[model samples]
Target chain A: MTEKSPGLFGRLKAGLGRTRAKLGGSLATLIVGRKAIDAELIEELEALLLGADIGIEATGVLIGDLESRLSRNALRDGDAVYAALREGMLGILQGGETTLELPSRGKPNLIMLVGVNGAGKTTTAGKLARQLQDQGRSVMLAAADTFRAAAVEQLQSWGERNRIPVIAQHSGADPAAVVFDAMSAAAARGLDVVIADTSGRLHTQGNLMAELTKIARVARKADPEAPAECLLVLDAGVGQNGLAQAEQFGQAVGLTGVVLTKLDGTARGGVIFAIRKKLDLPVKYIGVGESIDDLRPFDPEAFVDALLSGEA
Target chain B: MFTGLSERLAESFKKLQGRGLLSEENIQQALRDVRVALLEADVALPVVRQFLEQVKERALGREVVKSLTPDQAFIKIVNDELVALMGGQSEGLNLTGDSPSVVLVAGLQGAGKTTTVGKLARWLMQTQGLRVMLSSGDIYRPAAIEQLRLLAEQVGAGFYQADTGSSPVAIAQAAVEAAQRNQADVLLFDSAGRLHVDDAMMGEIKQLHAVLKPTETLFVVDSMTGQDAANTAKAFDVALPLSGVVLTKMDGDARGGAALSVRQITGKPIKFFGTGEKLDALEVFHPDRIVSRILGMGDVVSLVEKVERTVDHEQAEKLARKVKRGKGFDLDDFRQQIGMLNSMGGLGSMMKMLPGMPNVGAEASAAGAREMRRIEAIINSMTAAERHKPEIIKGSRKRRIASGSGTQVQDVNRLLKQFIQMQKMMKKAGKRGGMAGLMRGMGGKLPPGARF
Candidate 1:
């Protein structure tokens, strides 16, 4: 445990340190320790988890699991404690490694991007478009976010750089009609892929959410398997709140994958663990920078290693 | 625990509370606590320093309220300063532009760009009665186009998609053409986002700007992104000409530092805020209301606005003039004041708007309902003539009024004593500056009373 190089797990270790320190005071002290597990320790641990913003429901399940482990006399020293905690975490984290796989055989695998405003949905879409293009696929972009004044202009700029087509509408035009036109064009042109950029909206807003559902329905109607994948982009810096957004948007539009953006920006990326554990949503991509190539496909072992190892 | 924050604040306020006189040392210590709290809440360091400097300037030599402790007076000053720092009034989107005005959404990846598009679209269509069209220019992710299409349909707006071979610029140009052809009033372009602000992305966005010059280029940033959000906004400001900002994820447990920082750093008014992921969760940003909330005070600006709308200021002034002339403050006038206060979110909420007031939960405050009713009863029991002249009520009248109002004699005596004391205090304070001074005094005392 050198002071300087705490490895890839430095931030996680540091976050855990602060959480533990905050937990060390008053009521929390009575709940967790190196000694035998007790009711006090369980209650305190529960409080500690909730205080860490791990959320209420997840905290309950984690406490229950810990208690069962304790009752089986599986309690041990600090390393064992850490191992048990990791095991509990892994139960939620391990199986969600599948990336957004492209359709095996289709005119162009249409990947529909979605999320709340500021969730980096646009950036992730651009990065994913660039990534797919890099992988030797003919990619087309549809600037379906016709609501914002310069959104289409910005997306058009991305299209020019990538030498791809971006279907767009005016600043205040019908977004659904634009997508319908873009998809029809993509199908007719025999394009290998079409990535549509949607406007940022709240998952709870009924009308906007209904609009998203309608877009999916329309895409499917155009080609029964038109939207091969629906990727929900999220900000890594959002912590637990991002997970809640994921849950809502996932419920509303049926997310096929997730893109965790801004990994290089913050240390509180433990949200990945929480999202993986709770929502069971696969991390399809990881956005590291502003460059088009910065987007990379999700690799669970690499991610866990990078996160746990604390490497840049 | 959240109580840690509140307790720390209370301790600071305690230092400024009841003192025969306030010392410079006490003020410094209290300011130090406030600084620590602000910093801990993730306020930008520079903003905190600037805020502290402004507060220190305003607080020096200010008279402490007569009834309040020194801490209470200091807290009032600090609260007012905080409200000013956050901007005096809440501001909403200025959609008062020409029809089909362009509102550009810009931000880094994970900044909630797409969601804001939908929110703004719905707001325009529902609130402004404009036809909206949504388009996406993110060709990188195949799903991005489809996502925008789905959102457009959900919002009851038109959508567009381009062939992979066609350029995004061409698609955007064509989309604008499409909107013109359809006669849609508002066109929203959910532009592509990058992870970091890069040259290529900037050049590309700049090129798009060359083609379609939008009316408002809004930089969408995540409030939960903290300092990074501010930095990103700066980066985007350099790359694009931003007209306003859209802050998202405000519903999170953010101490609201980013909101303050973004406005201060960019000099751009926050156009809208995304409270939740719901389309309607988007709200126009109002600086004054946000300022009040940050100071742990309910929105006083709105309260004052409500009062201005409901209460006749001329009538209140006339009543005050009569009381000053020793004409006797009457129950009817008091009743009218109570009615005005009730209309303005009740006395409890008004009190919470004052500085140093502990935030009483709704349930605990509701427990005081009986006390309010008792006070109302005591005032209602007096005859019109008796109500007009408090001096006419003798000991027998007090007993009769107490019995009539279903209370003991002590209750009536307490009310009269309070009224007389208030009258004397008002007279001593003088006419012109008296009410202002009273309001300032009330600002200090309300906080301590709120604890009960």
Candidate 2:
């Protein structure tokens, strides 16, 4: 979207400015003029990681790993400690494969975008459509979010901008019915990918949770293995509550991956590690900006570098 | 979700209770729990660290009171700190400007900036009796302008139209000029937001601020953003002179890091809270009440305020007189109470504002709403004779009512049970201290199985 998109690392660094300012800046101040990793240093570092919205479980694991490494004399200095922290972050984030494996030909890759209200589910779906379209893949978008008054229009605007076909019905229509029609259309038209936009409902809403299950069930009717990727688009700004959403949404619709959005905003993006460590779901994409090109594949190394390179 | 911090703090205090003296080790352990509580609430890590340092300084070496336990004393100290950290009192809008006073709203994309603009406009018009003008400078998004225009029309505010063709600065300038021409009391500028904080977005907003020089620059942020809300508010504060913040979607399940940290981090008061998606769901931010709310202390003041706004005094007085006369509270009375609760944002929100009821989540609130609707439906299916005298409605009548209400017979039965329980409670109230006793009892506990 710029004259030329910045390299992944550069964009990542810029994308994580706020978080880096919070973590990297604090870490630098904490370790300044420090000769060794002492109890006080470890305590400060632990506070920093926990503060970044990294789950207590993930932070505990990282701290435990760091402490054991320190006890073994592997972590001697601040530099080693910083490296160890990076490695610890990567360890939690690196499990799932980053690449979204497309299914073999004959059936379209149906990616269902779901998350709680105001998590940018529709926007992420649009940008994803553009990302796939840029890859020379024919994409169709399903405006299945009939709950919000503006959701359908928002998705349609994205479809129109990207010049992708959008399957939509009237507002307040059954979202499951809309998804069913979109899948049928995608299959009929021989589209390479079908991105479905679900209505943003709080994970706590039971009826809405049931509606999501119904949507997934309806998608299966169109194709036996429909909704190949039920990507949960989580707002990185969400705190411990992200864990609850991930658990509940995972149980309801079966999340395959996560698309962490608003990373460019105030969200520290630390919740990705929690989502990974807890749910075993790889963050398929990270939205860094409003543009289509801002959606970058999640690279654990790049993310850590961005998050820790504030002093640099 | 915001209750997580209070709940976690409560757990820590529970451990400290029955302790002989507050030793250094015990204090440090308690501080660690408090740090985690702040962090889990999405308070910025640095803010959490500094907050703990202050709390530790104030809490340590303090003499224990005769009556209160060390844990209670520590909690009281923490509660005081929480209130101070959030601006100790509500700072309202600066409306001292001449006609066409301007209020500029800014925030990240999907942070409910536009909706807050509409709600603020409606609030200004209805509550403050000011003619408000609304305009959107969010040119990048395809329907951003249209969305604000629709919102303005819905709220009956003066709309200043701007298209994507114009620059954000130009849009702000035009909106101000139009507001002057329309003789509007206040002009609200809704600026565009990028998905991330970028130079282009901030630069444009800063330029708009310079041009408009609005009286109030409120950062509209999603409360769901947790700690990021404070950080993002800080970012905008650096760009523009932010006077206050609007914490949107407080009705949602957010850990409330933003509400807790925004004032401390940015040194700006949270002006209002966007409780729901509806236009009228905005509430004035009360720091002490919010601190109390966060501490699992019900905001009785706010509840009373809401009651004053929603309840019909004449009808309430009539009901009170009937109850005082011991005429008995019936199904019709229960239906009216349920309707009143629904108007006051339902049982769930009411339950949330109540103290010692932190576990009543969105799911429970929604279930309560569903139950209320069912009861209302069943009551609607009842004859006027049956409503006045429940004794006449036999098993055959219950079956007919259930069918008419599209509910199972058991649902009607459950409603009857709930109604009977409420009737007994009302009778007890009438026999004792009357309305004051009923009001006091309402604050103590919610009956486990009663739906209405």
Candidate 3:
């Protein structure tokens, strides 16, 4: 339901050349010479899926479905097998919410970005804020990530670059208080959205996670529906542990959705399938690289095709 | 380290364990289990295949030890192959050159390069007792240099500020000169995080590398990076003569399968692990420990080593002696004990090392740490009289201490009860022997107060 540039598939295909060789291109080889979906072809498909980091559990489910179909004499060729695989992934990825539903009140939609360390929460915060602003939402930035050194300045710089208002405190200030203050100020200023960039914390840190839930709770005092959207910012390159990250963050802050970043390289961002299988959160956005232009709404069709980009 | 349902792997190897030598069919079944384990652990598919092939070659028709099961013998072989691939033991920085040895830290964006740079500075300053300087060649990322400056200040290291708008090469040159002028023993140059596929950025790093001629070009990679870690590690190694890899964010739930991917691809030792957020949270990379972890077989040797390294033996002995002399264990001593627990990388770092450690995510350890911090805070709020003689902590004193510590009266009461148990346990352990006996006996099982 968001902007879809035509360059996405082409860019993703070019950037994901290595992954094509690892997953799609090799599978292309398997398909071109194959007579039918045999055991060896099925095995190669299994390896390709696993190689893409779609993870073992989801891969197992997909493979089991294929085997069951084969046993039932479905008589599927290699193309049918590939389409079935794509459809299976799309079954998991197709319907996730690409946008948040803001409340009717004039209160700002507080989108709190949370995730484990180095998942690019702060960077994604800036890009998402800019994207929302570009979409006619009067966006403001909040720097609640006071723990990391110079984190406030990072968000502040992003705001300065965008010519947007940023609410922040000195390093080591209580993050919840900063989040609340930013929310209330945004509401007072009648901003459409206030994106709060939270400090990256390991989901394993229970007390810190509790602090996040606290932040989510106290923001309601600023605006009744504050923190309307809590997005878990995840790195596309993260492995199977992305599931744990999504689960813990969702449990702690009740994340409304997830945003996968750093999709510019060979990392296929396949962990989202596993994550969606476990925790049924929608994919809100996907970031290609550090640039602001790289952030866009998640398009499952484009993503699935991008993975299998090279085909006759 | 392994996912649930991975109990022993012995059930699948029934025939292998029954006969001392494993049959090919049985070995294939066990290898299937191991293969699934590695895949679930998130090792790259190709790397997993390579690793399984080696394990198969070693485990095929291999005789098991009399005391060991077939699965255990096979796992031992798998663990050895992983360990040997990673490098046999802990490796430190190769800073054997003259003064102001340079180390360039590079990695993908958000892989914790800047934070690891801070931790590395603190590690160099403290462990080696060397004067260190920090500089950031990360001009592209906003506030990156400021982050390094703040970190340098936090770790008590000299910071070399590059001129405004200077290129990375100029920054490296200036940083080296400043280090020479300051007579700093080592200069850690933190570069901007760049994807290996970014040719321009890679080229820029190559130029910076030429300028620095770093004694160590450590690739700081996220432990959670999956199959892409191999491609990126190989690309970076090709772009630069990477001396080693520094796996960052190890304190998280990531199974660290990227450790194998990076090591196998780069053929470089992983030098350090940036364990936690703290500047002193860096740990020397231990291969056997990581191998056991990846293989889902925990060994107590590394745990004991960690305990020995972090635990203050002198303070622990003094506390025991005081308890023996009829001086009761006070709140202050309890606080010190909690501090010791924190210094030992908190509960999760230690918990993951125990053999047969159930899939206790870092949350359990974090909860224990939270409870310990609460106890410490409560003790801090207590009056000296109440702390020294907790018996005098009546209802009013309990309320006052609870309010001061921002805790409820019931929390205070629970702390007091758990403290009493700990006190009794300490007394019994004290009479039994020295701190070593108490540590070994009580270390695995933390005091009730610490366990929430």
Candidate 4:
């Protein structure tokens, strides 16, 4: 296993190595030789932004901003484009809250994790639960994902390994019923936090996604202010479709924050801007790797630095 | 999955439909639209640029005819390029050489790597009639091995458990030895997925690749990922001798840019696709059907194949005969039709094949799916006598069904009216011929305002 790098920014830089190579390095080379800011540079920079999966709407906004700056005689050289691009990216991500704000002291802060299938919702729930536990808060897990094969067992395995109590029903049970049970269990145990792992099979129209809303509604029965946070776990590679998922899930169950997983891979994580700009939801954390402690709080400045910090 | 692209291209071609000749400016304009579509679909920027360049050259130099519309010609050029970009035909696993052919599955984390292993194992065993064995090299996750073991047990594949204390290379080598001893026809190694492609993980995979000398090394990726899929596949291709690709989770709302981009970027064929989470959902990648589907032409062949595989022929023939004899279609028939649709990957997938419905967005499809489920639930809640005799179902019965199906009373009334209309249409077509006539008759009833 790779040890955690001492610096958070260093770990982030390493994690974003692929995106840096494709977007940052390419952008630097495209602009390095050119003295004047021209159509070619703008076009190549546009390509770079789109290549990073910065998305059409956001890229258009960034390029438009750069073009306006260019027209105003604000642009000087290649380094200017690089700085402008960094600043443009940061502008979108900066609006969202970087740190996870827990609910008022004594009560258990409930966070219902949601996303499409294979978006790392379960793993993120487990990691977040463990993180809260390590921070001296008593944490319990709700295995609300009883549909998928081995899903309940996966959550239970995390609970057992981390020594956190997991409230779960047998496989094929109603997920809402499972969360209800977990809520009761958490209240009885006097746990400080309850992280519910909701089903990610939102594409299944009828009962699977309906169960998420039901879980949220029932969680309130346990505590009026329950489910203090609803985090949508998005895979970094989800591209523009992440917007659709966020919109759908956000509208269905109000999203408090977003968790982008698999960020350490080839995904440029450009969807971060799209999610922030479109949904206006803060990215609470990013999953850097498979390790338990790899879950890091989202730091927009650090993330932007890691993303565009490439030498020509 | 490529609905967005198809719709954008449709719009672009509509602009060119007025023109007779393929002018350079018109071609460039349409190519620009194609470029945007590809970029939006998540095809890498560079690939999209190059693809549009080739398309531009071809479209400008094309020989136009009197019969073909300008739009049709443009679509043909685009379709041909798409088919060429993907490896032109379906490429299955190359497992002829080794007795226990080794297939190494590698990908980033949460890219459906482990699930693909199980699906591929099941597909090989059920479809190819091969004895399959499964092994997991993902020692990082505590339950990774257990998850694969359970999947193997569920699928009835041979399981070669790796020692958790051992390195990935050691585990893979031991699994290969066990597979040989067990006389398995195929051994699938499920390697660990790093959150990112780090040197350590790549080095580990490289070592495993050296020892296994696998027949095929498949890079599994999530289809929802846009340009990243191509980039990631290219990165992996640089380090390993990749045999092919596996695009997973086609069941999701992915625009399917990865399907278009990965092939051109990696220069490898996509061997299989994971349509759903089920073990039987793995399918051979068919380039022609995909190209047609992407071009908004609809994949009739795949649609027909799906029907043939899932629909009961004898039952269908019996129903056709019954309808021909003037016997009315009932709730039971309705249930069976809905069940058949469910079996053929549900309404969303079916809509992708029907003409003029390729670009059905997620919300509309979700509604369609919900409607299917509601109708099925209502039918299940019906009594045998009520199902057979709709005349016996009055207001009270309708209420009961509505409550039972968790739907409104209007829903029951709507369904019954729709059923009556369908019976009338089926009877009218039954006089002409069999089910083909029924489909043709139904097509004729589509609104005049409907556009392809």
Candidate 5:
């Protein structure tokens, strides 16, 4: 929304600057030494993928493909292997539905954010609300996370900063009731969108999952066809467990997409590849910084470029 | 569900059954499986490679123990190396020398820093009998200070916080003065969770560290964190002198590679682990227990320790005597039994430590706990006679008891049904000497506090 700033590709490239340095350092050593691309270079590539939170299965697949190509003499140098690895990663991400389609500016489009604790659901909600509001949509936030201490206040603070209204209940109130109230209020006020920030919970928590399903159900009671999209806020630093989180949350609430968080850090969040392989849910947006302005629509092309090239 | 590594290793190692001794060639197949398991557990590739090297050397040329399989011998070697690498004995906080020792808690955002502070306060008070004071320097996160204040209130610890808009150093300075004035033995300062890559935030924490001169700067980390845990912990260690670590979210199904990675990178003892969300759920880190878990051997030691620490010896003795007299397991005793699990970080945590036990998910076990509390409430509403003999409660009595407990009449019936089943199980177990017999099976591993 800040047109004066660097474009999405440049911003994400900058956010992922460290991944490029690390990967490029290893890749550079392999490519610059001008040695025959051997098993050692491939081993380093495998390590790079694994370090980026790409699961062993996918890393093995990529490495396996590289090894097979090596046998066939398909890859001549480290440069070919690098391009092949980038294309393979892009293959896992590019074909998925990458964007959220908004309903033409009329009824409220409810989006419920869900994830494990500390995945930045609240911060993403603030950023998303501001992004939508800046794009000419009236956004209201639903502080449905009544469980965590001060979660309501956190959302309210975001509302204050964005000059938006956030519907909240007492700290210990039922989160479903809070969502229902927000949806009803948004309908009354003719808001264009409602962003509900739910409490962070482990997907293995059956009661919490049931509570999320109930929230989605309650939103329908307030406004039919509510919660049009449920986004799982996954931390990029998560390893194989991200698969379980995605699977369980998808089964519990029927996740339409994912919002990968904390990508600004050293983590590449490559677990999204496995998540995509399992559920085919798009990585809609990413959180690149603590500032609200850092949320950007995910671009797989730029992300892959930064991850492999470290330069735009 | 991630199957225990032992079961899978046992399967693959079955091929090497005829081999009486493990040689470099024979253990190569086993080592590959182990490498994969370690990697799947989120252990960093570099750490995994180094660990495999150590495992290979120790596993090679070792005779299988009498009556123990070659796989068991190999697993023992790997487990021991892991424990040794992680610092074998349990390490306590360095709270000596000063009257008001400050323990500064820092970590990544949402890594449970404030919650760990609350748990640490309770742990210090319970173990060391120290009068602890809690303070929050987390000015960035909304209502973060209030969160710590509430936790302090819950734990009976004095709370301190600076005015809004004050920098972290100012809050630490003010809290230090307050702790001295209050004569608090320990001042637990909780800082805002920040990323190690964020230089500005890192600088702020470094500034706070300079101002407080904390006796212990514990780095709190989530157990579910991945390979980057090493880098993050290394960065933090480079920025501050991290005395130890507190790994949180152990209650989840994370493989806990972060624990190994953090220890490998920082070379610091993991002082405690946040087992559950409860204040009393913090546990002292045992290398053997975590290594057992990492190797998929189930942490029976920690489970027994949990039972020993949380189980009230007196209550168990009374129940044992009552059972020995054939007085029958009553509703009151059943309620006590339910409360025990609820107190000991829920049945979910217990399930995780038992080998071959199905992890019925934290949510399901949490639901089980809720059911226990409801049943306890129903028992509390009953009169002494009704508790002693649940059969005496007629239809109207059931209705009255249900309403008194804020539950439905059907809920009362459900409790009655469940209690009958539990009573039968308790009677069967009681005939084997009850709690005394259970601990008797533990040999001398039982803690001193646990008495027959």
Candidate 6:
């Protein structure tokens, strides 16, 4: 394996230096001028977005949109460039409304969380459960991740603190069976919501993913629309890797929405732009911390502001 | 079609080949290259802007480093600024808390959470000589408990696991109780990993925090995940009062922006690093070491220390003395050195610490380690006389050594040449001084390879 430098901050610092150098004299000129709709400025703008790793496809759309606006006399000057760029980027990002729709007339809205191994699926599940409880919803957790012995115990601990019920099975038991039991328990007890925590398996592991698909199938069997939201928890720090994961999980079990965990620690917040652009899947929630209330519903305007202004 | 930052910088340097001092135009050019590199490396845009403004202020009118070209001086300034942006120095784990301090491990799945638990366990056990207990609260994956158990065993730490059906909070509570009951010094609870930061996961962690109230909560992250690692760390930080970070898979070919970014973004220090899969492969993160590595300088001091510990000093001295006397340095000495190198963790890694040595590509570096085994094979093929006096054996002896070693004649010839070179060096060193002088010489040769 390649020995990458271990610190994200240092690499980013170096990365920034490179990005600045790439901007060249034109960036300064563009920044100083208030109104300038020149070809050179457009070229510099294109380089800037591409440098952000917005991916070529998204970059093309952003640049093309800006070019058309400029040609139509809709955009001019540095202020306009900033506004146009921000508006265009936000427009693409805001295409899909990022609200986690709660199911109406349900004792407990079941959200079946799924993702590949190491995708932060279980933590997202726990955080989501906590966030729901914090929102005044009585929540129950199900440790359906029976493949790992500690997984059930971990979820149970989360359940105990939240004062919620967590239905779990013995290690090595069928995960689908555990979720089935949990869902039944949630529905019977008139729980406000039941969050089923599943095992983290590799998306490429067909058998494992197939097993998850079966669990989803079994979950729907219990309540045809029980899993009100199958939130696929992805690490925002994963860059393009996370995008690939989103695509794979979307293919395997159609993702209702995405939960991007760890937004506070990465520079590739641009992955949000890519996910929005490519998958068109709405980001339902994001994890900013390891607290019960850390998971917040995705707000596009807020996110775009954070991306453009670095304030979240 | 697009140029990477490193390539672009190389091209720009060619344009300013004869410049004495950095003109505003050239600095702008260099900054452009730096900006592109940063963006490509997945740095946050705001951070990039802030950093560039600072660099521009510092770099605009400075004299270049003495005897260096304008490009080299610019590179130096950028490297220094890069180092400064990353908090300047590496921070370590805070074990200054009260005894039996709790350390919470937090991160997404596949971030090596369970494995980090083991690595930390071993580190505390061996380094601090503290009694460590590893408890898996990861009651999500079926084998999660077993994984921690296996890791605990590997690290020689006590393992705690509740039945798979048990509640994690109850299990955590019980494990803390168990740690106290067992008189364990440190209790490490490996929590369940998740795919995203959802309300449910946060609630669980919050609940766990209220119960355990760990002294140190370290968010484990994969450096390969880059910006995602930082984002997850931030989420965890807000959710739980994280004390530090443990970045895993530093051995992977990640660009390593996550390590630097997470701390700056989350205001947490990185305490430990998971360098490889082995239980002993964990390292205490030091910022200077990392910066040096990034600058392509080898970290020789650490390398030599490692060698000293692994190699038998007296035996090496004896071998050096023998070689100095023009005595036959045969298969026995070669075998011993090979054994020592192996104990010191492979020759390829040792070489990697030498400054200015080409990266030897991953494939070649791996093959280099295997080459030692071939050298050992050739030595093993030698007869007693051949082992003692390699000169006595001619072409027939080479053939015999090859056949006995299960290698070709070329292998024997290569070994002979290497052995002769070593002997010649030893003889020259002996004429000047002794093994001490040779070690000193080796030290001088070590820095370039070991700077980072």
Per-residue alpha-carbon lDDT of model 4 for B1-452, expressed as tens digits? 67777777878888888886888878888888888888788887777878888888777773455437778888988988898998767778899777789999998777788889998888888888999999998887657788799889989999998665988899988999999999999999999885335767777889999998899999888888876776677779998899999998887666788887888888989888887766888888898888887888888888878877777888777667766755666778767776767777666677778777777765666677667777778878889999998778899999999999898898888778777777777677777666675344334332211232
Query: In candidate 5, what are the lDDT values of residues B10-74, reduced to their tens digit?
Result: 45556667777676777888888877777777877778888889888777644443427776787
Worst 10 residues of 4 chain B by lDDT: B443-452
**What global local distance difference test value does model 2 have?**
0.77
lDDT of 2 by residue, B9-32 (tens): 878887898898777789888998
Top candidate, metric lDDT: 3
lDDT of 3 by residue, A38-149 (tens): 7888887787778778888898998898888778877357766776777888898877567877655777888899998888888888887788778788889989899999
CA lDDT, candidate 1, residue B156: 89
On TM-score, the leading prediction is: 4
Per-residue CA lDDT of model 4 for A1-312, tens digit only, reads 564332223447465433433344444567754588889888877776676678998999999999999999898988777778878888888865666667556667788899988889889988998898888888899888776667878888899888999988887788778777877787787788888897667453444566677888888887788678888998877888888788878777788889988766656667778888988988989887767888998878678766554221
Q: Where is model 2 more than 4 Å wrong at Cα? A: A1-35, A74-84, A97-109, A147-150, A169-177, A205-226, A265-267, A310-312, B23-25, B61-69, B195-197, B308-322, B325-328, B331-348, B356-422, B431-452
Best DockQ among the predictions, by candidate number: 4
lDDT of 3 at B291: 64
- Worst ten-residue run, lDDT, model 5 chain A? A1-10
Better of 1 and 2 by lDDT: 2
DockQ ranking of the models:
4, 3, 5, 2, 6, 1
lDDT of 6 by residue, A32-107 (tens): 3556578877776765564444645677788898888888988757767766777888787675656666755765
Q: Which residue pairs overlap in candidate 4's backbone?
A: A264-B196, A265-B195, A265-B196
After superposition, candidate 5 runs with Cα above 4 Å error:
A1-24, A32-35, A309-312, B1-18, B61-69, B308-352, B355-431, B436-452
Q: Tens digit of lDDT per residue, candidate 1, span A41-140?
A: 5665554443333444565677778777877878754334434654675566667547666764757677888876656666676777787878788788
Could you tell me which 10 consecutive residues in candidate 1 chain B have the lowest summed lDDT? Answer: B441-450
Descending-TM-score candidate ranking? 4, 3, 2, 5, 6, 1
Off by over 4 Å in 1: A1-236, A239-261, A265-312, B1-11, B19-24, B61-73, B88-99, B300-452
Model-by-model DockQ, in order:
0.07, 0.38, 0.48, 0.49, 0.40, 0.13
Q: What's model 6's lDDT at B141?
A: 57
Estimate TM-scores for all models: 0.48, 0.86, 0.87, 0.90, 0.84, 0.60
Superposed on the true chain A, the predicted chain A of model 1 yields a TM-score of: 0.77
